[model samples]
Target: MMSDCPVVSTKLGKVSGFALAKAKCPEAQQVYGYLAIPFAKPPVGNLRFKPPQSADAWKGTRDGTKYPPGPMQSTRYVEIFAKYVANYRVADENPRYFDEDCLYLNLFTPKTSNKAKLPVLIWFYGGGFSAGSSVGYHGQTICGLQDVVLVVPQYRLNAFGFISFGKNSSCPGNMGLLDQKMAMEWTRDNILAFGGDPNNVTLFGRGSGGISVSSHVLSPMSRGLFHRAISCSGVANCNLVTKENNDVSTGFLLKELGIMDRDPEIILAKLRSLSAKALMEAQEISAEYHENPLQKLDDFVTVVDGKFLSKHPRDLITDGNFAPVPFIIGCNNTEFCGVLADRFPKGFVTGEIGEKQAMDLTKIAWQVADNIPSNKLDEGVGLVKKEMMRYISPDDRYKWSKLPTNVMLDTLILLPGVEQAIAHSDAGNPTYMYYMTQQLRMHHNRAFSKDMTKKPEFCEADHIDDEVFTFGVPFGNGPVAKEMKFTEDEKNLSKQWMSFICNFAKTGNPNTPMSLTNWTSFKRDDQRHLVVKMPLEEGVDLMGERFEFWQNLRAKMATT
Candidate 1:
């Protein structure tokens, strides 16, 4: 049985994989999965906060059958959110073991020879750079259906992945991103043995993973490693990407860990000496120091390291100092619905919010003025609140609830998406933009409410809705599929979506197959975007007024 397994000789060693069960991917032509192949040496012990090192060659064939343990992270919030709001289970949600040594990758391929020359898609899972794993997403369906090779890499999470102590410190930031870079380099050298075209590689991801894709495009270190890019629901300029001082963040974590040393060498030695569990626990406690609500989303985040990133991503993109590759970027219609529901459950359940609640929410929405001076903060907040209030009627409570949700959707997701698209298109990159409008059938939020009875004026698509379709979850027999029901139309939609994505991966254009509607290139003047739904429709100027409002706000903040 051991000898019967499929084995491929990589640059480092020989690794064996198992044939995917037919039940897992009924539509797949032929998919073989090589799971948990070590791409870099484990980021553990003495190498804890340093950049990833290439894995050493092995003496014999390595077993890659079992899924790797998820990178170390606190899972309390993930479990609650997944079960209640998202209405789906996260694959390998909480494994029996978690570790700092989580730098492995899973490969699914249709051809196992160097001559197959299939296109390759490498995915980075999105957990806001705090919590997520490469375990649950099965690439068998994508590889089998699209005739390509799919790779999902695991990186360090939480403080272990992104801890930094400023310019003079030994611990520069972006360990997670560096881990992804190492994986790409490894793939470039060894994917041909797995029947993949190293030259035709495409990087795609959602949420923070999407942000990572955009970051790679801006980084000098990541140039020439990937050819094309796809970012869903997030980009480098998204509000979720933090602008906090990393030195302050590191100081907070040190305080939480009871370390008072001010010396960089002493701090690095102390941090490296702590156990993974101790570091993770301290990172969680350090959240109290971040006063900004948005900054608290993820305590550890990517920084503009001089080597990996020479300047801010927005400045780099504006100055045309990035890898100009074919890009696909967009977000769901209501990317913040779940967060709204979780935050104001009563308002969502009742379809109404108190006047005070509405005003408080408006102030929170205006926090996007992160650069506004303290002297002008009150004036700016008042101006935004006044404009936002005009959209809501005093007699209607539902309007009150909808106002904040709309503002959040605009600031956090939609505005950033449009800005990134405009930047890429203006710089002469072939860019395609999409807006997902198809709502999931299983979850009934009714515009950010848990109540199924209340029907909103329109259908709303929540965060990760596009990812669900992109990964072909509806048609597969995985944990996500078992939790919910999918209609015949939804299943078919998943197929079409995968086709478009794989087509882009193969040819750098989604419309090459010509089976679906023609997706036009996004232009600076036109600003057209594809409305992703059944019987796909085309439109121009998605949420124009809201986009302009944010633009005006930024302009005013700059002048004041």
Candidate 2:
């Protein structure tokens, strides 16, 4: 049946895609998937730390069914993928996979006829700058649902992608971002052949990838790449920024490899001499700087390089210099709660006064950002506690007082999301915001692995749950859905969510699809955001008092 699919002729060569009959779309005969096309030359040898080059055009048809190897990353991510991720399809089963020559892109088209030029949806994956692959997302069914073309590009990671050495061309940092830019350029030049409209491209991603999309919004180099963006659970102002002169971390890594010199040229040569695996293993930055939450979470992240990113991303967004495009931004309610819940003792959540008092304010506040001063950390924590008190009834204080889940959610996900939405709205671009509230039937934490086959228990909408609904993969159709036995509520919610995203891609406005509820654009004054649940509810002030507390504290934090 797959042999019936047409062969696409690109400038490089002729390649035929596999027919995807499993797609849930009834309008299309079948979706075609063209996998593992090289978008850039391998970043090997001298090209290791430099920006990616154009892929060398080939003479013969390459096998497009098999996914290309992903960028170099630690194998621990594979375990994390199995343990934590909810929607990993068959393509994502490769746990022990990594390579340097992994600059590839996968394209999925719903067009049964080559004459149709559909809108394009390009996805960038997130793994704290260390892990993720384009193969994980089963994009065929998702794209087929709306007859849109989907593109997923692989970029370098960790030491290979983000090891900055003070802004010179030899070892300039942000090579990962440059790789994304190169992929966009390739799409701009070649996507039409795959039946995609280059002008109607939408770039979207979750977590680190979402931050990358926000970074692209601020970068001058990514201006003409895409016309719209959908960033979920990550933003530039969320303290995700790393230091530009990351010499402290890079130098420490170089010294570990017996290269003690501070000279850029010498360090570059030494770095190139080391094997990819060895270099990846040498990514041990000092823990002394753990006070800074960003450094503690992911030190090797995007930086404000002079070329790719000239200024601080938040400053750029505030100054209205970012790409003027429609945006859909949201975050899960309890994103990191269950992940960190066990760290606190049982008495912590039970509101034992002594147990609550035992918890250190400075350490907890540091998790928010390293910039908070010692004098102000306790005060901020006190303010947060007071706000939480108001939300919980006097009878429920014991149940709510333990493990600062609300604090973490507000500091990391909510504050930054709302801030970015406000900034984007102020910059004269239409922005839509939402808070995902539906609890999903999946694992809350990786600790429970007794029966991986039996579906994990239901948990509050945690991080990356939105991706499952957005992609429309195994859940979109197949035996997995039959096995999982999704509820009517789950199916309805996924359909609504996918419809909203598809509508946004087709028309800049998401409100075009009258079948769905009327979604309103966010403004500074109204601050309206759709509370996404089974029956979607609109609210003007989401966590109003808590938001106000943070808004006031941010000014003081800025002054300090």
Candidate 3:
């Protein structure tokens, strides 16, 4: 590995990285990959529960050939979800590699020399804000095909990353977000050495990572760090994205860890002293104790910490107080279906009780406030039920049913996404909205087979389908079964999507040269959004009436 590696000098020291192999791209350029480069000091021992610090400069050349250990987090849902209805899956945590000291990053560059000055695209992976790593995504294809510098950074996770005690909290939380901020600062100051244009940095992410991107836009500390943003299937205003306060779960975790002291100093000391495994287990036990998945989560998630985040992201955006940058916000046709399908069994949706169940599911998906009156709840549920019935047929089974899937899609993803686009556009940013409707031949959630009849009953594109195009991975070359093949249309769609994303990274607009149609900027009055499908077509008023119904109902409820 050392013989053919390329050596580069960073602020810390001189480092060597291996060249990427087998990426399908033009012969003129090759993708160079550097893995597990430390951006911050290892947050262990006394540094636990604290913000990240810059890594110590090394004396000799360091090898950045191998992937580093990821941050400590549970793999419970990942293992189960991987069996059937999931796209991105995390394998069981390897204790040997998993550690608290996981503040690392990876970089991929297509430029042979630092003079190239290509646009830099930074990716943040999403695992419900708990389970994910930079190693999961390889930047070879994205960088090689798009001719941009790609960077993936690792941040702390779960309780270790986001644990705030209370109002006068000892540990100022959002350490994970801070880690990302520091990574951006490092990129802005140092990316010029890696053949990247620091001023043209574009931050893009999926799911929880998208939520993080939106949060960064709303954050004062993250201002001017990134020049553009793309959020796929995530919004900061979504109910599940942020919490009012996490005191209940924080207290629960402390008691489970056998720390009786409520004092912040003592609690911090006890938390820092606990083993990494023990800390993870405490949160896992707390999650299990609160069996209801919809309510308060046991694992730590984002909260409105007064320091990093002053107010709700929606409130901030609505008031025209977020980072002013071009925005691309979108959700898949079936954003939450892959995971939500697991909750309903084979013949569960076949009666009057099924109606009640569907209503309950919609309520949970929207995270409806308890303060809303029962009459308003019934009105809202009735309207949603009417809208969902249009998609559900009588013969459909639980697995094939579109009722619950549509409800989840509208309530969780589409509505929040449009809401965000509206806010950003009104705030004077050039916002582009989209709904991804393409079903790729190769996707992690899709069970592949040559026989078309053997395909699963789910029709809509599942979560993370658009991710394949975003990363420039060809359909046949993905992690799915090898028997499947990519068609001409699939290849064209992938190329077109990649072109749009690369153009967005280069210039804030996604409308580029290759595609036949021009992606128009989002207009609040018409609410036009590009229906991202095989033959990309523009659609007016996406879910317009249905979304308006909910918005009106909400407004009416607010008045009463």
The candidate scoring highest on TM-score is: 1
Question: Cα deviation of 407 in candidate 1 (Å)?
Answer: 2.3
Write down the worst ten-residue block by lDDT for model 2.
Answer: 449-458
| Candidate 1: segments with Cα more than 4 A from true spot | 1-5, 23-27, 84-96, 242-244, 372-375, 386-397, 445-459, 478-482
Worst 10 residues of 1 by lDDT: 83-92
The models' CA-based lDDT, in order, is: 0.76, 0.71, 0.73
Write candidate 3's Cα lDDT for 1-560 as tens digits. Answer: 44665687888887778666635545325667677888999999998878889888898988777778878877665553343321211112232357788998888887637688899988888877777777556666667777899888989988788888654566768888889998998888778888899899999898889988888888999998999999988877775657766676777787787788868888888888889998988888876654345543325777788867887766777787788899998888876555544455454333323656666666555443222555666666666677667656766565234565676677666777888888889878899988888875543333443422221335456676677667655621234323444556766777788788889999998876666678888988888888888888998887767778767766776786
RMSD of 1: 3.4
TM-score of each: 0.91, 0.89, 0.90
- Better candidate by TM-score, 1 or 2: 1
| lDDT (tens digit, per residue) of candidate 1 on 1-560 | 33444799998889988776432446567667787889999888889989999898897988877888889987654653454332222233444367888999989888888899999999998877887888666665677788989999998876788887764567778889999999999999999999899999999998889989989988889989999999987887754464433666777888888899888778888888888888887787786688755555566888877767667676777788878899998888766665336555375646666766765665666574245455766677667667766766766647667666766777766777788888888888899998888877756533333433222433367776676688776656434423455666667777888888899999888886555678888987777878888878887877667677878888888786
After superposition on all C-alphas, the RMSD of every candidate to the true structure, in Å, is: 3.4, 3.6, 3.7
lDDT per residue (tens digit) for residues 385-420 in model 2: 666667656665443433255666677667777878
Q: CA lDDT of 336 in candidate 3? A: 52
